[model samples]
Target: MTDTLLNHHDEGPTTAPPLLLGPSLGTSTALWDKVAPELSVTHRVIRWDLPGHGGSAADLIGPGATVADLARLVLALADSLGIDRFAYAGVSLGGAVGLQLAVHHPERLESLAVICSSAHFNGSKPWEERAETVRREGLAALADTANARWFTPGFTVPGLVEDHRTADPEAYAACCDALAAFDIRERLSSIGAPTLLIAGREDPATPPAHLREIADAVPGASLTEIAGASHLAPAERPEAVLAALRGHFDGYALRGMEVRRQVLGDEHVDRAQARQTPFTARFQDFISRYAWGEIWTDPTLARRERSVITLTALVAHGHYDELAMHVRAARRVGLTPEEIGAVLLQTAVYCGVPAANSAFAVAQRVLAEEDKTEG
Candidate 1:
């Protein structure tokens, strides 16, 4: 259905990889507040509200809406932002929407994480009854019981409860309708994206068993059960949730490290790892994940081609130290001494004689060291 898009909050660098965060039924983008910022450091995190739940208009969805409807709105949001593919993570109803996208719109997802959600939602009976009650009496009565249903004992998030209490009854009931009709059990095996299932160990609503069922069905899917957490794992146990999301979404980290070693050499990587402190660890991971895993691993350009471009950039920027290291890398990647000199010559033409002159000296020193080693 053609409608105004859902209300959303966009964070992090726009140029970073996109990650869409979806909220549970009664909650808004606020559900992700605790975890989104950390994820935003590596990704463009876009958190969206359910229809009528926050800033979104009630008319964005109507009664008898399906999870498919919510999924469409999410896709519409991504399209508007010019994101063709993204990693997705969601909580409860939001997780169900992620499942829908994984099953039907697999091409749009780089990865999927379903947190405290299930495929069938324990059938349609309970949701239908809940929908009927909300339609007749509104959300106040249900909101009063949300804390027990959502969190472990002696814990609560007041803002989320307030969101539940203030949600439009009609729209909330429509989300229930969507839940009532959603049953992707049969289609679980068809989901092709890399999938992760996070279960709140103490969650009464959708227990660990529910997430396990999904993990068993989805190919290559992994599951993580967070201790002391209930339905809203990201809120109750933000660190645990963040760790799982990073492990799943950054599956590239291992590959990136391998590529880094290949391009930078084992001695360099070993020294860097030995020198890594807490402060520099994240920066190193960014280099491996973004530079080697993504840009270098991409097959569109050969290693030799990348070396040429990298050398040119290093020369133009006059980063002599970096240029020296890459000169060694260029040799490792199969660039000959003559080819390296040719690249430095081109840099002299465009990058200026002085910068290229410095680059040539660095390259010459590196090449002389290599010759001595070979001798």
Candidate 2:
């Protein structure tokens, strides 16, 4: 028998930001072992078992449960854990839940990363047929075909094969029912969370193009491909997948503390963080989630371009204190003093000399102070 969805295990620091990891169909939380530890370094990682897999038995997902229902179950699991807002990463079926979470509950997600997954899974007949097979004969009925699609030719994961063999038939079939009816291609643009779509070049399951459609629909979403890898890219190309995931999630400040330190100098960020009080807690959360998570982490623009834009906007708006702070960060991010001068000079031509003058003064002083400290 399967345990309730509430039985999902939690990992990483108790104080860290929450991250949910969902597994592919017929797999368990054990699918994430290679990747979870790396993420847990800065996040409270939850390895979620798929319904009817591992400890979560088939009975938990009776008839009428869709991916949306599975998504709701994950949310309920979060609520049970006291995590109001969290980040998510998943593969295939797990990734489908991530998609539903992004589209339906944007406010609840800090960031979303989907690997070897698709917006539509291409067709419903195959899934429906698979669901029927499992219902009639059990998980063994579908393991051979599933195992083939999940890995590259001739390279097998015995553990995952074992996982497929052990999954509860009713639960596996129920999840297939969710996949068969799942189609959100038309609604992809509505997703607001930062998204990373990864695909395997050799994957016959949900090929690169399936992920590409999603990448095109979701604004600012990025697509990465792994050469020579199949459906289970996260398992097949573990290191590459981990690197891409870390960069994507970290950029959003899901581990915002470290990302903030990297972008804004540790001493300055530390001071601001230490200054937080009950009155300013919400404001702090806003900056961490929006500024760091949404804006700074955006993959559409290079960090240097983001810095240039921030410096330019600050100059235009006369946010002098923020201008000063960003001036320091701009330098750390590789904007030279001469380049900074060029921005102010350009600002003077259109934004007017007064705005430019104040920015010029701030940038010069900040840069000079750095020179003195280094000396």
TM-score of each: 0.92, 0.69
lDDT of 1 by residue, 1-375 (tens): 224988899999998889999998888898988899999988899999999898888888888999999999999999999999999999999999999999999999999999999998999999999999999999999999999999999999999999999999999999999999999999999999999999999999999999999999999999999999999999999999999998888756788999888988999899999999999998988888789978999999999999999999999887999999899999989999999999999999999999988998899999999999999
Query: On residues 263-282, what C-alpha lDDT tens digit does candidate 2 reach at each position?
Result: 99889888998999999976
What clash pairs does model 2 have?
A: 2-57, 3-55, 253-256
What's the TM for model 1?
Answer: 0.92
- Name the regions of candidate 1 deviating beyond 4 angstroms: 1-3, 251-255, 345-360
What TM-score should be assigned to candidate 2?
Answer: 0.69
Error of 1 at 88 (Å): 1.5
Per-model lDDT: 0.93, 0.85
lDDT, candidate 1, residue 171? 93
